[model samples]
Target: MKEKSNRLLSLSAIGLVILFLIAARFLTTAESVRQSFWALVPPIVAITLALITKEVYSSLFLGIVTGGLLYSGYSFEGTLNHVFVDGVISVLSDRWNVGILCFLVTLGAMVQLMNRAGGSAAFGKWAGKHIRTRAGAQIATILLGCLIFIDDYFNCLTVGSVMRSVTDQHRISRAKLAYLIDATAAPVCIIAPISSWAAAVSGFVEGENGMSLFLQTIPFNFYAVFTIAMMLFLVAFRLDYGPMALHERNAVEKEDLFTTEERAGDESLERPLRQKPGEVIDMLVPILSLVLCCVVGMIYTGDFFSGESFIDAFAASNASTGLVLGSFVSLVITLAFYMLRNVLSFNQCMDCLPEGFRQMVPAILILTFAWSLKAMTDSLGAKEYVAAAVKSSATGVLSLLPFLIFLIAVGLAFATGTSWGTFGILIPIVVAVFQGTNHVMLIMSMSACMAGAVCGDHCSPISDTTIMSSAGAECVHLNHVYTQLPYVLTAAAVSALAYLLSGVLAVSGITDNPFVSLFGGLAVLGLVLLGIRGGAGTKAE
Candidate 1:
């Protein structure tokens, strides 16, 4: 009955969308509703339907079609061309997208190789002794994610691969694991001064030293800081709510690793090739090499060997290209290492290439649809509409400007699935908004933009970081998205309130200390956790 009800709801929602598209023709004769509020409707539709139906691919495709209809002014031929040709084909055809896809495929193959060779199994045994509890596993994953703050792309995949075994051994749901992976990726990167995200944000500023400004803004980055805090609180206290709590219960009580059919990978995460130590090197060596090579590849692309400084090279590096080169090299090195170890026969290793690719197919398809949806959203001028709206609001409210900017930034980033783009578009306008009138407010608003962008990116299902995290944890993509949303929203609310207080404080000339809002946000987050988690021990306890 519930399943039937959900289907009915989804169909009704689709019906509404169809009605809207039909009505749009009479409302506008233009080919597209570019640079308008309607520009955001498609992604909103996509996100809503996905959440409602627990279906990702169809939700995204329908979103693409909605954008097509909006952009082509409800013309059938134009909608088809717009969605297929200009949307999906364009995104897949891009070289950067291709590079990332290849990296995912190659990395997937490497993971398969390690599994078949008993390397992963061996590592699980090694970790089993040290990581004795679910909290330890979660915290360890969080620490690894923070440690790899160099790039979100690198952080998500590396943490997922390294930590999966430990997490599964504790019967932690992949949904929860994915939430941890995602919660750390962009949020950690956005605040890390040495990270690729910092580099990207710095380039957007015109007159000021971008890195310096980013550093200054870090204290005011409430969403990022509070997100980290929330994760620790959740794991340390064995607390979860909503879908995640259900997943956790299912994992621990039922021994059901995945509660959904979307699980393409196996409990290979929990199974070991051996209970001994020899095969341990199989997992560690390649992971280490992959990390080493990826960093080297990133710097190489930035022209580090050509005499550029470490930071400068990283700033200039093309992450997509760097990761592809790094993963390809790592795969070759792992294959050779496996052969020499005789853990798997050469032919068996060869077989893993296809198996790995097959395992990654689900991720690839989802990513493609996601990318296509983003393309449609972009073509509709979503970014421009957001920028214009934010600019119009910036000058209207003095005490509320920072909070309003944060909300706008979040909305834009969530809809478009790109935090970098959201901040890139907003940061300049923010700088211009308060250039000389109030220096403190300027900093606060800029920080809000950064914080909100990461927050929105965290919640977005189509976000690259989100997708990568799901792939890394081998979780069903939509399952990860839905489970993670409540956690993200909890932090976002606290951050939003903190920013609002900062704005009010600034109006009272109490803006000198960043710690005011920072500490206050932390307190609120803790209290919320305390209330939600109770005087917590693990669920079993």
Candidate 2:
């Protein structure tokens, strides 16, 4: 009865959201306002419905239907065209979307290979041998998740796969693992000086005013900075929230939330004595080589070394190509090392490759749909409409530019599920908005866009990271989405408040510079952290 009631409530909420979006569309023909308001509706409705109904497929399908309805409302013929041809083709052909899809496929393949070769089990064995405490295991997982900042999808799946056994051994919930992966992916990507984000942002800004724009916006991207800090702090201090907190409490009480089959991986840690002398080295070497190649590739892309053409290097790091090549190379190395040592038969390795690819089917599907959605919206001018609406609405409160930009960016990214799209739409507008304002204000606006996009993406159930995080942790997609939303919203609220304060201070000349605003925000964060810690300690006592 309760479940039925929840589902009905969710359906009602979704209907209301759709109605609101339709009304908003009717209210404005101005591209920006229409896009912005419409953009806000889908994700909020999708997430709320998913949470209430606890159904992933239903939630996603409803979003797609809503999007299609919106597209159709504009024109019946256009809607048919998009649904039949454009949606499918756009997902398959777009460069950015394809890159992510390829990565997901390759990652799934690699993880399967690792499992087949006992590499994943081997790593878990090694970690279990060293890290005995539950807290220690969780910390290690978080740190490793943080270290893999090149791509959020990669970070989520890779970290979750490699560490799942160890985390389960420690009685940590899969939900919690998903949270850690999701938290680290965007936060780390946002701050990593040399990452996909840096490349994307650099490209957007360069197209507008060249490389100098990248330099100008770095200091003010406070949400990213503070988000990463918050993740680290949560790890160090053992902070958890709501369901996550309940899971941690259960762990402390040695209660089991996972099934016996789920805990089977942990048992593997106890019986891993069958590999050859060089098997471990075979696994470690390939992973190390891949890391080295990626690092060199990133540097080459950055053209940081003197006289180096960054364009060539950047082209070379093709994340999909790199991962594919690296994984193939690793497979070859593992095969040869195992063959010479007589550890495994040729048939076994060959068999594992197909299985690996098969595991990635779900991720591939989700990615395709996500890409299609992004392409459809982009082609329809949804992003442009949203950006214009946001700019116009916030024009009167110019002093609140930084905070407004942050909210707008979040809204845009949440709707589109693409930070790159959000940034591309907002960077120019933000730059223009702050044209004669203090340079600090410009920096803050830029930061707000970057930060807001991340925050929105982090919270949006439809966001790729959210989906990937579910895939990574093997948590039910909607469960992961629902469990993590509250935590992300809390962080966003704090970040929003920080941005507003920074804006107010900047306009009043209290903090006339970016450095001052950043430091002031950090100081305020510190006080908040102190209160959080004090409260936690009191509860503990």
Candidate 3:
């Protein structure tokens, strides 16, 4: 029965991909065979194979093959060179891409180190010791995820990996684990002031005006704030959606949703225990120091202490030196503490470092390929074509700009599996459109784009953060994708309604009156919550 269900799911996913391809072919204005083929075929092929095989490597390989075919047409030799030589080189050399790769490598290394040091085990032990109720356990997972706002990729993978044992021990499903990680990733990134996302968002805003851009957009970033709230609310109420709700019930019955390998080193930590007084401090000190140093380093690099503007300070930190330096310092301090306590010998620490590096290999590979795909798509002028289509079609519907931008941003992000690329393409266009109009509208439109990109990327299974979350939870990758889609779509539907109201209110000159938009957004959210409750109740009945 399970095998049949899996087969049926795979077939349905394939059908969806086929439908998307058909839609893209009909909608795209690009007349070139190459442009049309690449845009339509790659994602379809990748997703189809992924759903059918339920294998990460197979999905990734097919994605690469589809991309290569788009780039080099039918020639095997041409495809090989484009996919291997140019793709790899381009990803390695580009600064932003390099930063992403470096961050992933460092994150993987950090997770491995934490695992080796038994930090996660210690955490699981502590949680199981204190958190006697299922509600407490779920709340702990959500709070821990919220705390790790340094980077979405870092948060998703690390939080899920660290909390998985605890959650599973407490009878939480893998689907819920994926949901917690997914909920935190984009929601936190959108709100975090000091992250790679902040740098990217700041760049887009600065390119338009300056610090005012950040200030104006913050209030309208409803999805970011609302999503986080929803996650917390769900945890507080023990609410679940669709298949996720069923998984929760199964977990209560102690039925495993999927097989997980038990690590050989530590199986007894599930019993939980209080850390010695100084032990928690020892773990926290390095983490806090790392964060402080990152902030100070960013200020120093950006020359903020020397009286540079906010934008300039942000631009300076774009080098990623701050993150790299901060991570190294944290690693050294953590090792020193272990050495001082005789927890590990210097030789053992040195040996562990190599293992840490080895663990990052998969992340490095995936990041390299993801970056390569971004580069190849950019080189093909895909962004320009998308920009052109939007500009041509939405000429005078200025009031609809925010909703339109949101739709376009979401569509592009979903297709490309990249929020950064979507923002890079749309922000400039929106900025230009609002150059002579109301700055408030401009801010709302840009905010909509950011929120929409995050929404789409959060849902896209091919997204690096999404894939990492699945990997972290040790769940079947496609299962994670399918399970989370409904929740994401629910949030997205509310978000779209919010964007539409924001646009209408902003354009009608009532935006300055906060209550109008605020009440309007609240009304939509109320309806969404009612719908969710009704649907769940109906299903239960």
> Which stretches in model 1 have alpha-carbon errors above 4 Å?
266-278, 535-540
- lDDT of each residue in 1-541, candidate 3, tens digit only: 9879977886776576556545654554333544343553565466557657675455665566556655655467977887777776866887766665665556555555555555666666777889877667777777887887756765776677667768877887777788778888877777666556766776775446444575567677777766776665566445667767666776776566553332211223222122432244434554565566655655566778799875567655653666666566667777787678765567766765655556555556656666666655664567777878777755778778778888888777876778888888888887877766777777888888898899888877677787777656756556677777777777677777777777777677766553455556656665666667667721211
Determine the backbone clash count of candidate 2: 5
The TM-score that candidate 1 achieves is: 0.94
Lowest-scoring 10 consecutive residues by lDDT in candidate 1? Answer: 269-278
lDDT of 2 by residue, 14-94 (tens): 687668667856764434433544544445555566666666556655665555556566466766666547776756776
lDDT by residue for model 1 (399-514), tens? 89889989988988888788988888899998887777788888899999999999898999878888889989989888898888889999999999999999998887866687
Cα lDDT computed for each candidate against the true fold:
0.84, 0.66, 0.66
* Model 3: residues with Cα > 4 Å off, grouped in runs: 1-31, 34-40, 93-95, 205-207, 255-278, 304-312, 471-475, 510-515, 537-541
Clashing pairs for predicted structure model 2, backbone only: 31-385, 32-385, 32-389, 33-389, 36-386
lDDT of 2: 0.66
lDDT of model number 1: 0.84
**What shift in Å separates residue 218 of candidate 2 from its native position after superposition?**
3.7
